[model samples]
Target: MTNTLTDETSVVLANDPHWWRQATVYQIYPRSFADANGDGIGDLVGITSRIPYLAELGVDAVWLSPFYPSALADGGYDVDDYRDVDPKLGTLADFDVMIAALHASGIRLIVDIVPNHSSNRHVWFQEALASPRGSAARDRYIFRDGEVPDGTEPPSDWQAMFGGSAWEPVDDGQFYLHLFAPEQPDFNWANREVRDDFLTTLRFWADRGVDGFRVDVAHALAKDLTYPLRSHAELEEMKLVTDGSHPLWDREELDEIYAEWRAVFDEYDPPRIAVAEAWVEPSRRHRYAAPTSLGQAFNFDLLLANFDAGEFRAIIDHNIQSVSTTGSSNTWVFSNHDVVRHPTRYGLPDDPNRENAISKRWLLHGGPASQLDAERGLRRARAATLLMLALPGSAYLYQGEELGLPEVADIPDADRQDPTFFRSPGVDVGRDGCRVPLPWTATGSSFGFGAAGAHLPQPAGWGSFSVETEDADASSTLNLYRRALWLRRDLQDAEELTWHAHPSGSDKVLWFERPGGWHSVTNFGDAPVELPDGEVLVTSAPLIGGALPAAATAWLRRQAR
Candidate 1:
């Protein structure tokens, strides 16, 4: 629920102030993108080797997930060293080569920067542990003496976002706070040393030629020192609290912290871009996107939305108006490394009222495999993507999205690595399914993902979805993406959408126009709908009898009347 500009940011103008307004950025999970030197892992060399492929994918920029030195406790987010590249990922020289390659291809790069917490293996954390209580080292992090009277219970009852208690007690009568995994401890943002060090980290990367940064957990960094223990029911309400004074999320102090970071970003040429992955309430979103602060915040309402036309319309209208206040472009996204792939999520039976709502349980508690209609899900996914791409602001494409990949539902529990899976003690299978290594060829040990085996097992027959196979098929989802992205460039113009009445006069079908002759129509209903009088530019699926089919979308050019 982080309002992180995750749902926002696409293109950039490193030189032109408004490049991000209309760019199509691709997110690459290095762990799963491509593997070079095999070691059963993806690395910087692999990412660099694929620069030409990304150039061919029609993306305007690349948003890389963290590749810093880490224990992989929470993938790479539990960073141990902010200034250095992970030895497994590659060296600093490799990072420079990768950035150089991307720049040469006319693509911008936005590296992820994690400021909320640091891996316990980090020097600062270790130093804090070895130092005596109330020392300067411990002061940099959130360390407080436990509850009074021999200090048995925790200082507060704050539970970790993943699972279990948020307070990890040491031998002494003191406890440390970790909103996420125990391996990752939250920083004391109120401490000037902690704040100053982050400014150093930000400058370290910006000096490396990284165009911008995607701030991880952008909304969770600032916290109220008062550990107010609330009821369990109330604590579970929202990803980010918006009701009254919340101690853990979206605090008034966060804006000032971002403003400081914004000042550092401004030190760069043309000013570096930054998007907050803050998941705050819609009303509070503008604060994160304020021009003098982080500059952009992600609108995640669409990612959490069901595929209903009304839901999509409402989300679009809300986001467009929400970001308008801060003069930030609306951002749209469907899936990412954290969520279940959209194709699979959309495949669930449309009956939201069904007794079985999606939960952390396997299959997302989304009913039996037979109940998941894969065809319907893929169809809706294609249509939904077209709708997202046709919107005014920028859009993000997660790796394997173009291949129409679904959640790898049956990964062996023993092979799972996400902290949630371990923390949930197997109740929640975690995000490993969506983070599985990608298939790149029709046949190979790792589906051409790498010369060696992939760390995570690739599903059988997944080769059919490989880029190699899709490139040859005119009807493959990959080809559809290629064509759609190609055609979308001509359609991306207006800063807002002008809703057009559907010819079928049904609210289930949506029609909208951008300035130019470009227009888009989508049929979310069960029946086909007549398209406007325009030349068909591109469609998600084949038209049925010259009408847009159910669960489909189309782009067109207005014909001369």
Candidate 2:
């Protein structure tokens, strides 16, 4: 099979052997992107409308969050059917249009595959429940007898992500275990039928022309069959619940299943991608992303690593080293639909409260900080983006991240749709705070994301922080993102990422030298430090030393010597 490489060598490399490793992906939470049919919800058409925006963003692929048929129990995570699009989101024809538009824009599409579980309302589940006994349909799920038996308590003291036990008791003398919600019954991967069912779904989408998938909880698909639940005395309850106790994760059975899937992918003239949403430690995440396993798994090093200067540098360096160890391909993403927006997590400076000054800077361009403050934060974000693009692994962009979007602090409980919030609701769970509909128009209601009174709220003030407004303003963050993306694409060397640590007295700065002689420098903290003594190629930093004005990020390139 002599595959002809594209002018962009990386694209060819991505399309070859294992395409996902080298692919650049942009994630779109369909409900919040852009509503084209005035349904108060962003649908496939909405995503199709913004294909140009994504094309300009320079991403090789777009990862659409689940828009499948569902009961909306877990904000679509608990899928009812993998075969069709959710009516609220769009029709099957609409999805075909989206795929066509993306392909026209030179972008591939990867849909979310929630194989770990399904909505209780799913037909399969209904069938299983009706025939809980020795029925072929019952073989699809893990149906066991007795209360997940524990020593005078529930089995394994494992807590559900939403709170309570990971198991829910069923009336039929047997119980079904759900790692997430009672409504989401875990599929018994041990069953051949279950494995075949998922593989069939994979073929269904591939035949439909999807680029691939960002598999939901790939690691969670398998579990520890031992059924050994931890004792109640564990320090943190969550620790006992999620620490690799499932019966299906990383099981040899799973590895073999992947090998089968890999064979299927190989049959296609061009390889199909399968990126696992494995979000554990660096080492474990690697296991799922090995050559024969998932092509690429999500990287959490940039998101969950220590905030200390030395720690950050080591983390980045370690990630590069880790991928090298795999001798296969890999991917990286700092933020996604599942986590809080980076600016907020990166700790941007909050604005002083003012009665009349509520215009939406906080949600769109970030909070109302001073020019230095804004510049500092913007630079930090850019530096991060630069590092992401310059790394050996593929990078993922959550929607609105390029425009330096920050998390919204106040979404009403009624409007929240994330399953993470439904579980342990306190300081907000997962990333609903950052998952609001995108703002595409300055003067239109809901930023023109949808008709007024939509399911999701647009930022409080949409007249300013919108795509229409930012497109006209040269200095707008949206334009800056476009510039960076275009520059990356124009520079052939950008695809061949080459990185080296710069000489900084402190570990705060993570310096990278890209293929086209571009350098990116970053101080991950709120306090400013002196820039290294190199040609200040490009920097988003405001000042050399002082309070970094919070969320400040910058880029610098060394002059040709």
Candidate 3:
């Protein structure tokens, strides 16, 4: 629980400029993390109060989801004001105090920066709406004239990510573009004033002692400006294309913007850093972390991969190789606020379109998965966690994953708040299931999350996974995470990873060794496997008669030959 890093890790951190290359960061969804002042919403003070818990959790840094002034239209991704804190969350003074406390705990803070778009309520957006179509104010956003003289049709046929027309009509007969939700209007980054404003916003936080930022929608900032319509097939392929012709995403011009931001980052002491939430192809993903841009980007291939050894190994290898030339480190993530909790996903029966099925129907009424699937999911989730943590490079852990929390798939339709659900209406249930408030105590009005009701309902059975309940049991997922994190402190920042040959020569089992005599093995086959000749550091499940059980992972200190 001590804040001090081990001597070995400390030495590496002191000498290496890129300390984040192997750092373990914990992602916090602010509203769901903890609630203070009985307001039914989490705030800066709530986060400040939990620093001790985070320090004890053994994370090097905490990446908070957006807490800026917002309407909560897209879980705060629709930012209204970049320079100030939301009154509901707390004042800027509270944020300063929280930053100091986290630094005091030896944990860094990374705030979310939503640069691609601003809330419709943002002052700039308001001015743009009130101004003429060709006025200077309108130039700050992507406002354009309609295709027809009557202005009945949209300017283009681009579709929104949340399932609607990307363009929203205004009173002036012009339309503005918003790739996600209509509440969030995409900024015209080509405008000098918009660029200057964001730079000022960055400096504002850096001067306040905030460590870094996680740039939201980092790949979509720069648009091609041609306003071309894409075919349905082309739209589908855009998500995975590299050096693609897609006009709205992963455009080459984004690198210039990142370089400009990186220059601003270098002006401060210790040099602030950024991580991108980009969904570029494996070949081009590293550009966001090029030497002159943000230093790291989230690698979501691991999250999307099926629970198979070959798929995982292929993703790991491809990711590690992708960033090798950029001097940027690879980032691994399993579950996040946007995706279904991995436990629930892993427990479902495999389908050719498993990802799509899980995405659209995991939380729907009469969905495929059941309670029995949940038990199997938890087992695989535990094994996946150990395997992910044991891998090389940086890793990100979502807020409640340590408690083995499953997606609250049965949330009532009336209680759902995600914009995606509202936009699509019954087609996509959205992300509210994964964003439910955390349960800190075994019993409380809202499981100790708040004195009042939570914004999203916590399932009745969540008390079983509460911090208090898990902390009392050594075999609990919470303790497993603590033990793994503490043991991982000894792991060196080595780039080399060699896959070990399975004794049975089966593809279901995976074995790999790090350069410093650290080894990790996972069993996905139907039966248990004999442990290699090494001192077992940690195992996801209890070993049976000296053999590791199926759906289990073990980390070990390899014995000398």
Candidate 4:
């Protein structure tokens, strides 16, 4: 018998009381964060060791990427066992220790929850595969025979995100659906049994004392009206599936599902935080994070906010306007395990200024190309870090980013772990670039990760961009990140500041004013720009320079009222 909440006493309509709103969440990709056992992988114990660092960095919470038992097909995104921790990342007891340690440091621990699908190797899927066609357990997955109908000849044109058909032929006479990799099978959320099993999984984690969850691809759970076999073969397999314009990403469908989850959260007081990973447009971002729905939906507007001042300004304006209208806590993300670092995205390469004597001299003398690139990259990296921490909404800092980690240089095809890279074979390398192990020390085969090789190779430039080197230097990118984060935490109005922004110049340079007489001037330009007269607060580059220094940014305190 379960202790289900009664409607009368449950108060299902209650709002979320979790302290996730406006709280900075630091996302930790477990496998690459730190390797403690010399087993070439980061473990729960390793993550536990970094909890105090997160606290010191002023992040209110930590969101651990999937550490559950898995075959590592999609880098742990494909979970074979939900209840147990993967041996590579440590045991269930190790997880408990990490959770307790994080909590002790006043940092909430949010685990990743992949409810939309499980690995094909999952026991449920394995059993379903072995069971008879008409079995109830088999019905928990979308199984269709032959081709289904659509407006066109081929079944409904639903293309998989990674390319090719969304349906994969299985042992049975039917095909199973997978929005992502073929190894990850989609679950039939419409099925009551499936829902019950998922709810059980949720409860299992809740009992283990997880503070919250970042639901992976939450909107991808629901499929479109079209039942597709395969789409056209040309240009990326062009599958004509419902792209959220139709009923696929509809609010009603998501709301109905979330209502059930909300009930689960209500059952446990100090309501567990639920942040959705739905990358819909900015206008629709709030639909999933409605007061009655998930607490927050990561806004990729920041991801799209690159170095262009115009684009960055529009992002801030859009967020401010949308949050005001929807009355929902705005969530801001600059970087994640899945995306490229901001500096790499924004910082443009420096072309030799033929007119400038120094640049001309360097080019004429055949100066090191890599050296020039490094100099340009370092300045841009510093600026992006400043801008990321100053943003008004609840921000997410990806692991290793604080140390100014750059994208992985070049790992061979066999070494690459991202399924997207494997499937596409260099067409799009996917997220493996950003998931390299953090560089802890400047020297050693493991960069002080452990006695053995790292789970993922440290970026070739790790020595120059390492935490150990930066921590000892005040002007380093790591120190800048630490200072900016501490400043965000120390500000008395940090919690109360209402985000307000105007067109500082072009949309590229965003000029935002916080409630407590603070001004954030961001120049996403490849060249420097002037700041409005006040006192120059903190800048990635010297304010004396006319140019903002290609992707330079700064936060200033507005003059006293």
Select the stronger candidate by lDDT from 1 and 2.
1
- Cα RMSD to the true fold for all candidates: 4.3, 6.3, 3.5, 7.1
Residue range with the least summed lDDT across 10 consecutive positions in model 1: 1-10
Q: Candidates' lDDT values, in order?
A: 0.84, 0.66, 0.85, 0.69
Q: Which candidate gets the maximum lDDT versus the true structure?
A: 3
Candidate 3 at 215: error in angstroms? 1.0
Which tens-of-lDDT digit does each residue in 1-561 have in candidate 3?
Answer: 122234443343343346677888999999888889788998889999989989888998899899999999999999989998999999998998888777767777789999999999999999998888699998999988888677778887778999899999999788999999999999999999999999989988887766689999898998876645665467776666676567888888887888889998888656788999987777777788886999888988878877888788888888877787888887888888898888887876654543643464534445655433887889999999899998878889999999999888778889999888888986888898889999999998789898897989998888999999999999999999999997887775476788988888888899999877899999988799987888998999999998999999999897656
In model 1, which regions exceed 4 Å deviation?
A: 1-14, 227-244, 351-362, 365-368, 559-561
Model 4 scores a C-alpha lDDT of 0.69
Query: Distance (Å) between predicted and true CA of 444, model 2?
Result: 2.4
Model 2 quality (TM-score): 0.83
As for lDDT, the candidate ahead, 1 or 4, is 1
**Sort order, TM-score high to low:** 3, 1, 4, 2
Error of 2 at 390 (Å): 2.7
lDDT of 1 by residue, 402-488 (tens): 999988878777798999988987477788888899898999999988988898988898998898999899988888888888777
Cα lDDT of candidate 1 equals 0.84
